[model samples]
Target: MKRPSVSDSLKRLMAPHSIAVVGASRDPAKIGHAFIRNPLENGYKGRLYPVNPGGGEICGIPCAPSIADIKGKIDLTVLVVPAERSIPALRQCAEKGVEAVIGITSGFAEAGRAGAGFQRELGEILAAAPFRMIGPNSEGIVVPKSKLQLTFSPMFNAMVDGPVRIMSQSGGMSGMIASRLAKRGVGIGALFSTGNEDDINTADLMEYFADDPGTGVVLAYLEEIRDARRFVKAARRYRNGRAVVVMKGGRSPAGGRAAMSHTGAIAGDDRVVDGVFRELDVVRIRDSHAAVDATAALSMMKWMRGRRVGIVGIAGGFGVEMTDLVETSGLLAPPFSDKVQKKLRPIMPFYGAVGNPIDMTGTIINQPDMFRDVLNIAIDSGEVDAIVILLTFVGEPKIIEAVIHANEASDLPVLVCWTGGGEDTSPACQMLYGKGIPTFDSPAAILTGLEALKAQAGL
Candidate 1:
């Protein structure tokens, strides 16, 4: 019989009828505990069974000894036992007719020859059982709609319920990026970590998210392309007129060696991989944060009507730096027209530079209203499709407020480069974050983030 596709498997994985935790533990530090606690704490709307031979009730919930002892059907099982014990647990899950299994235990093929043999044997056993598997060394999956977090990352936040899905190979990177996106109130429909590539791959997740109604954008972090041709086909199909940003790691020989040591997967030609991404209209990124920023921007804003960008900075030096970066990035900082200059001239103080990269200068450093006035003129004048406001750390208490108000007022996407340190870093970062504005510490990070947004908008 023909096997079902990954899209079909993900359906059962994301919204299972009954879920069982095979290695449930009482300790909160264990991955098994996270797998069990996250779902129940988040108010998972499905039946949860904890399987442990020595288990009594955990968190006031009854624990079953094994899958065979469970009364009803089991749709999903998370195996968190030692590497050697995973296959037995999987066999038990298969016997109970469980549709899918997510193995979070590590030390599989990534370990060595014996481990690779163990992983292959496990795969062969699963093949006959007609069950879909996520990983022998994966961090597991997260589905926010069900309020389920199967990974052991505490940084995961359940914020804005947007139409974006993230598929990453690094668990730590995924958690960090997800946390950053959550701070911006950008919701993710699903997040999956494809560690070791033992069974499930990124291509499967891309195809799954393509059909998912809740997913409008996809952010991918890949070290290798297991099936490059098939991945491109799925990526093109899922574009949805939106963007798919991919960050391919393992570029240099050193990086490839490190990646191989981590996941035991071959690192392919990075240049050729990038070419394929360009051919398929996939926006390639350099870092995980770039992927997150691009996904957030593209998921919120539409394509730019024009590539002409306007720079509004608090100082001339910052504006010059921004211009250099933007121009070098294949984007243009077209000169503002005479009419735009005339309109903006009266609002600014006498010291401001009023050219393409308009410099608001030090006059507005302490004034909150100046932030709003300059952005309003540029957006209202139709001279620019996007605006970048460079702000140093010397602004007033409500400096972020001014930027937030300007962002809300303009239809065009706004980028904020907040540089400096003050009494409260959390509150200051939170204010801009609350409004969905991208804030960066360095000018280079700001330009890179904006460039990603530009690519997503096809500017």
Candidate 2:
């Protein structure tokens, strides 16, 4: 058997066996203390060595003065020291043969002119170095699989595991998006907050995740990319297998200024960015939540080459919106042929129609099996290539199971849109979501998700 070829330095950077935090602090309020608390609290099982010149103890672990004092193999160094000490610290890490350094200290390029100059100097010192660095203003990384939680964010404590790999220029943005997905019961494979792009840029990680078997989708939040050509090439490479969702910030002038202040990288022209994304065949998203939705849909369902959509639900309104969406998006709601309709007519309720939008009305609450019967009949009838089931209310959990079971038998993809009854239907919706069915709470959202999935088909 052969192993997937990953950059040796990147492997150490993300999945290091041993690590040293250069500025471990005793105070709980300090960022340095977070490095200790996050990894320790999250059950990281690697050898941890904290380095502080004071030679004090933090979280019951003794500190080393520097990398020079640390013995054994050191895979990575998390430098949380002050800006004045960050450059020299990188030099020391390089000397110690550290494979990577995560610069968590701020006051770099985003701070202003002098800080930008200092950051340039820091990058110069790392030229052709043995180890790669993540950020000078980064929040660090979290590898849930390896139990390597280097972030200080509290949200990571409850992080879930899944297929999306995150790349962000802003650490807060990365954590917030991944946390949102996690809160929705979605899993995140790895998250890299590549602040300032001092050494390891966004392009490098994208290329790495392209070959990574654990990653099924790539979600990126970018204010600025240092190397457009490299990032595009990486996107091209990753596109051969998985889905890439990019949410580019800084389109307006004010937003551009804010983006520069936020990450110290210039936002390129928005039109040019759009063209690049279009050419690469990647989905360009407008917001974080939509990015999550798209990733969820892509990760769960099989590619739907045929767009003949079928709507099944108790709510007639769901059928209306689904029909409208299909009309607008060039999707089809091809009515069941007379032969198939005649075959299913006796089983379907007399009051509701069995056209493309087979609304069963609220009577489905009484006969839950009727829902599955409708689904199985529709799938077997060969009238539609895809299904949009409106799981409006939870009359019985068995109906939900019926939907799942019915969909499992067909090659056609199924999307469940649970609407109305407000909070009453949430449990069922989440159940479907947990079962890997791109479940949405409303008709509009589900239709939008379907359109996104359709847009990315055969890419």
Candidate 3:
């Protein structure tokens, strides 16, 4: 058999109508047990069969002795058995005509020479078989839209369906990014943790997500690009429609060694990788925090018209700081034109600075309408491509409402930096988030979001 394409394999793997847990366990501490329990708890509307030699029930579902015993077709099979037993179990799945397999069993390539040899045997089976495999050392996959939680990671409990789709080499990194986004009131449509990349790699997943209508943005965490040509092609195709934000690991020599031990990855030249990302217009982030922030911004705001930004705030000092930060972040903070400043003057206090960073001063605290007026004027003035509003301890519903209304009124991207309110700001922040406006606590974080917007805009 010629085997299936990456897209075809991923379709079955991601949205399988029937799945079998090859090593389903009765013990809760085992990965097999968690895999079954997770999908059931997460509401996987599929035919789930647990394959265990013990021939018992797992979480109320009857277990088959093996894939051969399963009467019906298996769309996907997850192997959680030990390395020694993985090959035989995979062969059973192949015999059963399973469409895809997730090799959740670790101790493959990352486990040293013995593991490498074992992985090669698995690959040899897959090369001649009709089915496709994900990993011999993979964390599994998640499709929130279908409520498919194939991984044993407990992080899927917090998973929600949204526009951002994540593809990471490390399973832990995928969970971390997803958790961080969820905390920021953002959700992901799908997650692919390509551990070891023995069979399916990041490039394959990238091509799949590129055409997925539900995915508005793609976030990736990589240690190395095994096939740079295929990766560049997929990234180019993906970037044509949605933003691709990546965080590359193993940039340093020491980090490269760590990556090698972690996933058997060989870190290539960082300078060459940086050049490729720049040319492809990929938003490459360094830390997990920035990855989450960038993903949220790109997924929510979509894109900015330009790098020019209108900074509006209630506090003057924070306004000054944001002004400096915005410019330093490679974005423009142009002074408001005379005509625009005229519209802003009546709404501002005498002590307020009404230039680029329009400081409403503390007086706006007493008059919330002034805050609304400033945002409207900034949004309508057309002086800047986007707006970043700074607020502190001002949790008034009207303020949040004004932002929501302005965001809806204009095509320009609007971001909020709400800080110092403690628990009081939760409702207001939640409101902004609900409206799809990116909200942050610190000025620096807000700028990080804008930088993502800038990258997506190709500015």
Candidate 4:
């Protein structure tokens, strides 16, 4: 009897029932300490073991001198020990039937010479075992909904779980994007950093995430992909309706060299990466910022079927700018029908223009419902597939609530581009984000994100 490739691997890799933190430490400042501290901080409800040679206690839990000393079936082990100690530690975990291990130490192939040799030995140990490994230089994993923040970053402790699951080769990128998305009140289902991938690589995780019940969007930031054919197969298998996004780094010669040194992996040809991503229908993004935006939009507005959009903004200048943006991004701002315009004519300001970019005019400042009224009209018109709401100032709770209500009533996706609102906008923007509306700071980003969403649907 054999463990099914997918289930046996990911159960321990992701939703582990019990774990042992192999270099679990005393000092909270140390990465070693994070393995124990982070999980508790995130409210992990599973059994946790701390392993140290001079075992006493870590965070008040009884410590084990080694994995063999631990008294139960260990599902996972987090190796935060040095490179020299990692081989023995990994061997012990595997012998003890530990299903998965995530090594967070940095001194492996990326460190050169002696470290490379150590990495090779570690690889051989992995190949001989029934266990799976993530990295010797990884940052661990975080599954927000499971209360599993297995990584070392305190910034992710308060993060909420959503449909976007991020898997990156760089731990810093995973944290940065997760924090950014979390700050906007967007939920993150899971995040993993696969550094110096010797055993479990991005493709394995991609296949897992593609079928993950919690994930609606999968974002990967790759310096290099270990297996291209496997990646394409995974993409095709899981791409039913979910968006699989990739941001391939190290496109330039110098950058490729840097990536080699950084991950101890070759940065494969960027052109081939692009072609494969296109052929597999994967959304290839350029930066983490855009990646975060794309993830949020795709995860939340997956129902959006068309590229037609309606613009609602306070300033005529912004409206004009957005008009240009729609044209450039290949998105359409369909004209409102005559009957819809007649209905809107009563609520709109006498002087305000109402075309595709429905400039509600500055009169919306005092009469905020006028803005809400326009939003209702645009949504009701059915002329647009999505609505772009740009605000110069976001005050008036009633109008916000009204717009939110209107947005809830319509199937049309409503996106916000808010700028210059200063302090008052933060809470309001957060409200929209919490409701799954993707918000950006500028006209270009809003339209650009809309276009990306449209592109995701192959429009």
Candidate 5:
């Protein structure tokens, strides 16, 4: 496989011979301050060059008043300057023969015409220059291998290292998801936010991640596709190395209206986008939780072993809803064969929804050991490839034990859906999450995660 475009550029940015922060600052509140602080605070192992007209030494690094003050070829320049100042900074970077520029500035196309004009000008500058640009209005990019946290978002500095690479059109969403995933113990290998995507779009980044050795899954959140053809082609090529899971906004007209007004995105036919997603084999998320949950599952679990899945939940109604999701999401829930049914019949005394859904009734709530026994039977029967364990309320300690045991016993990936609300079982949920089982409060999100896993594994 060919190397991704972003990886080499990323290596330069993360561990450049010298890096200049164009809008380097002393004030802690400013975006520039955060950008400079990340590398320093997180112990980024690279040469740091701070740039500011008034600079002497900001953040204890030797400051350069301008890009020219650098002694040799500067590998990367991070633009934390204002929207109007980006062009001059790009000109300086081009003059300095910098390999890449991370535009952490906003107020580009996302801010409308004047901002759009500024973004266009920056693009023209890059076109005439020899360097690559990550964004004109991006949060910035991160390459874990180089320990580079180029974004101004404070969260990136605290990121956990993992095999997934993330790209988003919304910087805030990207930061938010990355933060939450880190909290859940899933680190990202690289992260990019192509704000407005005037030049370095998601497709280009996806292509780069496709060949990146560290990346196993690519998680994306888009309001629109700037380059559809490149995205499809890249996704197809990356199918094995990196699975692309997307969460696109603008489904309803209300949502579409909001997306357009928010990011100047042209919200076209969502169904058409869906079809394109299908063609590219990209998994589209329905909600925020699904994005993180699907990322965890896809990054950790194998593809679906079979189309048929046994969804056993302590809650009867939640199991029923999961069954509905399975059918609608195109996964088959074939009825259990008589031989398998006989094995279950002797164990399950109460008449639950004993079809493919395999509702354990409230039996597991009382007899937690039964949960493991039932799961082992379900997985062993060769009737289902995956299991969805739904618990309404984890009031019993046995249930938790059973879940842990079941997870250990089964090779098939198990997704847990814990229904009900409030703080009663947050501990239990966290416990399950710690064990590498994706846990969710919403059955819909859990099912969505499973559906995405099935789609990616090509079951």
Candidate 6:
């Protein structure tokens, strides 16, 4: 029989037909209990087998005494047992021919010298075993589309389906990114928390997501890179086709020390990492919120054709501010050409400016179509490659509809920076999000999103 390739194993690991939970517990307080309960609650379609020495039933499902007792082929297995017990449990999985495994138990590698020895033993077992493993200290995986909540995270309850995929070394950071994106009305297709990377490292998953058609953007949170060569190769494969936004930790000496203790990962020099990322054409963002903003934009917007942005706003002051932001963000805000300016003159009020920013003044409050007209003109013009609309306290449905219509009718990316108006403007924002248009609450976030889109487009 042909041995399954690592990619094949990863496919099974991501969307398993049958899963076994080793150390499945009846106690609700334990992570073992959450592992089984989460899948059951989330409507996982796969067959589930919970293994426990003293088990009869867990979460209303029959429990086997061990993986050996499970009668059928298991595609994936999750181990939540103690570190000392993980070795024997893994040996049982190897004997049972499990295709993939996730060791959720901590204590090995990250727990100092004694634990390192244990990790070495586990590696030896995997070397001879047919199945590949994710981690001995990992939080496991979550595939929202498959209803595969393999981890014990409570965030799964709120996760929606979208094109963004998150892969992080820190489980907490992974959940944090997912939650923040969710709050912004952006959803993730899958989340992979590669805890200790005992076997399946970041580069492996990067290559996997590179081929995942459903994923449009990959949001990664990294503490360190274990294999630079493999990482660069995988990144290059994906960079041209999909947007790869990375938020790297451990830039400082103090942060580096913390990262070492947290994941047993050695932090690389920041300058070298930055250079490698730049060479790979990867988008490296330092702030978590900004990273999510970038991911959301990349997931929603089309690739920008160029760095020239057409800024349109209801207020003149914000138009000036956004012009400054656009120029500072390495984006161009050139004045509209004579023909483009002629097209905009009639739509603008006499008091309004009809230059690059195109401040339509307060006239748009009564004439909502003005917003859409300006967008269409900007998009149709050969001058700009993207459009950014600034709305302050204007939440009319017609105005929101205009933005959506303009976005759908053009290949150019349209972004909105909506401030003030509180609840009145929220529905407009939600409507834009529903139509797959990128919207931001602040000017800074909008620029970050635009920068990400430009970078991904290689503009």
TM-score (C-alpha, index-matched) for candidate 1: 0.86
For model 4, how does the per-residue alpha-carbon lDDT over 1-459 read when each residue is reduced to its tens digit?
132364577766778889999888887788878889889877899999999888788888978988889899998899988888888888887678888888898788889886878878887886677787888788989887678989888867767878887888899988888887776667878788899888788888877776667777778988887776788888886555677878888754343443536334544566667667777768888887788777666766444578788888778998899888897777887778888888788888888878778888887878877877788888887788888887766646776676678778987767777775311236677667667665676776676567667766667
Residues 1-459 of candidate 2 have per-residue lDDT tens digits of: 121233767888778889999988888999999998899999988889989999989999998998899988899899999998877888888778888889898888889886877778786777757777888799999888888889878866666667888888889888877776665556787888888887788888988888788887788888886677888888887554467788888753333443536334544477667777877867788777677667666665355667788888788887888788787877888888888678668877898878888888888888887777888888887767678888766537889889778767777767777564322326676666566664666776666667666656632
Candidate 1 C-alpha lDDT tens digits along 1-459:
244566667888988878898888877887778877888777787888988888687666788988889999998888888887777888787677788888888878778886886778776876676678887678878888777777766777464457778888788888888877776666778888888766678887887777766677888888777676778878888554566888888754343443435233543466667666767778888877567667766665545666777888877788888899988988889988888889788888877778878887777766667767777777777878778777776546567676777778777867767776211256666676555554665567667667766666555
Best by TM-score: 3
TM-scores, in order shown? 0.86, 0.88, 0.92, 0.90, 0.83, 0.91
Better of 2 and 3 by TM-score: 3
Considering only N, C-alpha and C atoms within 3 Å, which residue pairs clash in candidate 1? Answer: 160-187
- Itemize residue pairs with steric clashes in candidate 3: none
Alpha carbon lDDT at 159, candidate 6: 73
Order of all candidates by TM-score, from best down to worst? Answer: 3, 6, 4, 2, 1, 5
Which residue pairs of candidate 4 clash? 162-187, 162-188
Better of 2 and 6 by lDDT: 6
Candidate 6 local lDDT, 1-459, one digit each (tens): 344677989888878999999999999998999999998898998999999999789989989998999999999999999999889989888888999999899988889897987888887887787888888788989887888888888875667788888888889888877876776667788888898887888888888878878878888888877776888888898766578888988754333443436334543477667777777778889988788778877877477878899888888888888899989878999999999999898877878887889888888889987777877888888788888888876879999888888878877777778776211237877787677665676777788988888777766
Residue 8 displacement in candidate 4 (angstroms): 2.3
* lDDT, each prediction: 0.75, 0.77, 0.82, 0.78, 0.74, 0.82
What is candidate 2's CA lDDT for residue 35?
95
Evaluate model 3: give its TM-score: 0.92
lDDT of 3 by residue, 37-79 (tens): 9998999999999999998899999999989999998999999
Q: How does candidate 4 score on lDDT?
A: 0.78
The residue pairs found clashing in candidate 2 are 161-187, 162-187, 162-188
Model 5 spans > 4 angstroms off: 1-7, 14-18, 107-112, 240-242, 250-268, 345-356, 359-368, 392-411, 420-435, 457-459
